[model samples]
Target: MINAINLNSKLEIQAEAFIRFYYEETKKSAQQYKERLSEVAAEIRETGTYTHTKQELTFGAKVAWRNSAKCIGRLFWDSLEVFDERSAKTEEEIAAALLRHIEHATNGGRIRPTLTAFAPQKPEGSDIRIWNHQLIRYAGYRTPDGVVGDPASVELTEAIQRLGWTGQGTKYDVLPLVVQIGSRKPKWFPIPGEAVMEVKFEHPDIEELAGLGLQWYAVPILSDMALNVGGVRYTAAPFNGWYMGTEIGARNLADADRYDELPAIADLLDLDRSTNTTLWKDRALLELNSAVIHSFKTNGVSIVDHHTAAEQFMRFMKREQEQGRDVNARWSWLIPPMSPAATPVWHRNDLTEREIDPDYAPQERPY
Candidate 1:
């Protein structure tokens, strides 16, 4: 009984913290929301709970995206479509909403950045979680010789398997969604194939590359992160954005820890692998980046190259200054991994990390 009382007291504190943060971030007249604030305070006093209005919810979600330090894609932060799914408390309802998210973000190949904000954490209820790293991701499997899939997904793949879900262990196997409702056991839901759009990467110059069978999804929908709107934490808010070519070409496909296809790509080009000075790696990287950009363009999918993306980010910064908003960013992320000197962001030292309200953050994993 004492524990319950302490939990209720903590909830009241959290509610008040969230209220203060929200009012400050939104910059709306407090007098206009006096009645709403009073109602929230009353609910916290009685039931130890509170809710946000749709306007507040939308504004919070957008600002969170804007404050994302690691996202170079914040140039389109205002373009994010926020889907308030606070009512999706059940596992089935959440699964249905995820499907809708996939379909909408795919957007018939012209991917759209979208966010689905679920219920906030409650004192008495369990927090909802999507265990998958992304709504759509390839599975990684542990094998006798070596890892047969994406090494990054190996942990989540095993977790999904523990939840009674299995994948074919192919080079490109879409993993099932592991949805958990509060303290209840997690369940797996298979995504409809039609909702996911993938493009096979083939270099414009290399005709034989198509036979290698490499493809990537049109949108990257990250699902594991928590969305902290003001002080209110939403554990199941999944968000997505259109791909940046280098993210796929340089990191996911080229990284030694990831796909590690650079060696094979170099070999196919018949380049000298005998020494590091041959510039084989550079040549291979260019071809890979070209393949990704060309494939997306051929498939009529929306994708941005690193150079162009950096240029757009400069425009975003200028616009933010005009609006009298501080542009906080992570320099390492704002610069592309493939070619740092080629882009203007490389020379800029203005990017710095700062504490900002309403941001998406990484959650601590249960050990």
Candidate 2:
């Protein structure tokens, strides 16, 4: 139990933080937000909360990406393109906007980090949300033999099927977008082929490995989170960053619960798996990572390896410090899972875990 008074008090605190950050980041005259704050205070007194203006929403989206402590790619946070779609009130409108998001984010193979903040959830209105973890993700199916698709997406895939959509049951099939507006039943929209840009991975050392049929999308657009600007929560804000090579090579493709390609890769490399000292998994992982890097680079796709990503993060921290701002970071997330110790972020103790406002928050899975 929470009471209305307590909730409003918390909202006031969040409002202050967002307004202060907005003024600082945009260098807007303090009087502007002061006047806006008075209006927000009045609104809260009547309705328990207030909404953000288009300008505030845009800047808040960018700063939220900047405050994502777990991201090693925060160096380009300021470059995020923000789309304000707060007026979108229908499932059809949202789905159309999402398609535009996919195409703009794909950027004809050069992915751009983008965020589209839709209408915020209101006390009297239902939330507008995208049920999928991402706007573009491969489908997963649980078959009698075993899982036939991305194991991570099995639950979502089943839910989509139940809603009257079908997949080709292929490993690389792009799932349809599920849009839920207010209290309406969720609707499915097929993503156009031109909106998705996938890169087929091939190893420079092992050219024959290309025949294995492994590939991944260029951008990682996470759509299943709430974007909290001040105390106002936008439930349908989707955002993305250019993928790091390790995210595709080591985690998505190599994680045991996901694609789980390590064993197959080790067999192809002919590494002895009998002894723990042989480090067959490590050898195979390095090859896979190398292949991902080489493939993305050859295709002119924007990607960063763990080492370079860490180095860029360091530069971001320095720049923030020069601007009299402290960098908040979650060490566990800032360091890549594949080679943690080899990166500079692993040895650093200066990182802080302080929570910041205008940030994206993980929400419960809709399915």
Candidate 3:
């Protein structure tokens, strides 16, 4: 059985201690990956465009960008483990025990590198603010439900503990865990001797900016190295990841606008005339499909003949280029629905029935 408990004082203390241990381990791991860190930083400075610059860097942007690399490094040394105990023990004591075990596993019984202490804040009213550098910005929150399972709960609790201290009345607080795994996305490792914890948090509107439906949203799109020409890599500009959205289309348009000198390349790649409503949507879907296929192929799990398929795609693009025609791919209108009940068969917003009448029966209603 899974239990959900509000973090009390003792539990908070245990969480803080566990976070301290995590940070110490993370800092050490970061130090070890200093070379990789430098490379990633240099890559960003050289390749990344200035989305917003006002004489200095903003904390939010810095955190968003650098945290990805920092976490990759942290994963090399630290791992999360959950402990499931059937013994009769208070939640606080269990949390404390988990912290002790984490400490033991992390530093061989000694805390070396100290953690950066952070105080969680509970904002008042509907106008919630998050800090960017020293400036506060308004953000909305949408509470998401937790996955229904035992392991998920364990993961959730451990994740909460890993994020330092939590303040009373704070909602949507996340504990940032850093790991060094050389990848942008976080990889899940199974916790030995325990079920993973199920956790839920308020989903942010920023996620919608990813553009690939609500559920498929993820940040800082993963790279497609297979499509790289030399050391130069191409990715969907706005979202960076393979997923398509309005923002990504906007970026493509922006790139096309920069094709004044390379008109031939522009025509070859269908950069020009790609902004047409139907054409752009089609291209987005194809690019998205390519990205997905490439990811699966790279992971060595795809059934498709990746090398031959990639060669075919490249040849198609080349043929289009030769003919001075833009390589515009069409997207299918038939996007699969997320679930059976996800669709609305009909809608009458006004004077709508609030509940399904069980006594009325299904056959009683007109089909």
lDDT-based ranking: 2, 1, 3
Top model number, TM-score: 2
User: What TM-score fits each model?
Assistant: 0.92, 0.94, 0.18
Writing each residue's lDDT as its tens digit, candidate 3 over 156-186 gives 3344334442212222122222211112222
Candidate 2, residues 116-150, lDDT tens digits: the string is 98989887878888999999999999999888879
Write candidate 1's Cα lDDT for 18-128 as tens digits: 555566556756664454556676777776666778877887788888889888888899898989999986888999999999999888888888999899888687999
lDDT of 2 at 179: 92
Residue 15 lDDT in model 3?
30
Of the candidates shown, which would achieve the greatest lDDT relative to the real structure? 2
Model 1: weakest 10-residue lDDT segment is 1-10
* Over 4 Å off, model 1: 1-30
Residue 180's lDDT within candidate 1 is 88
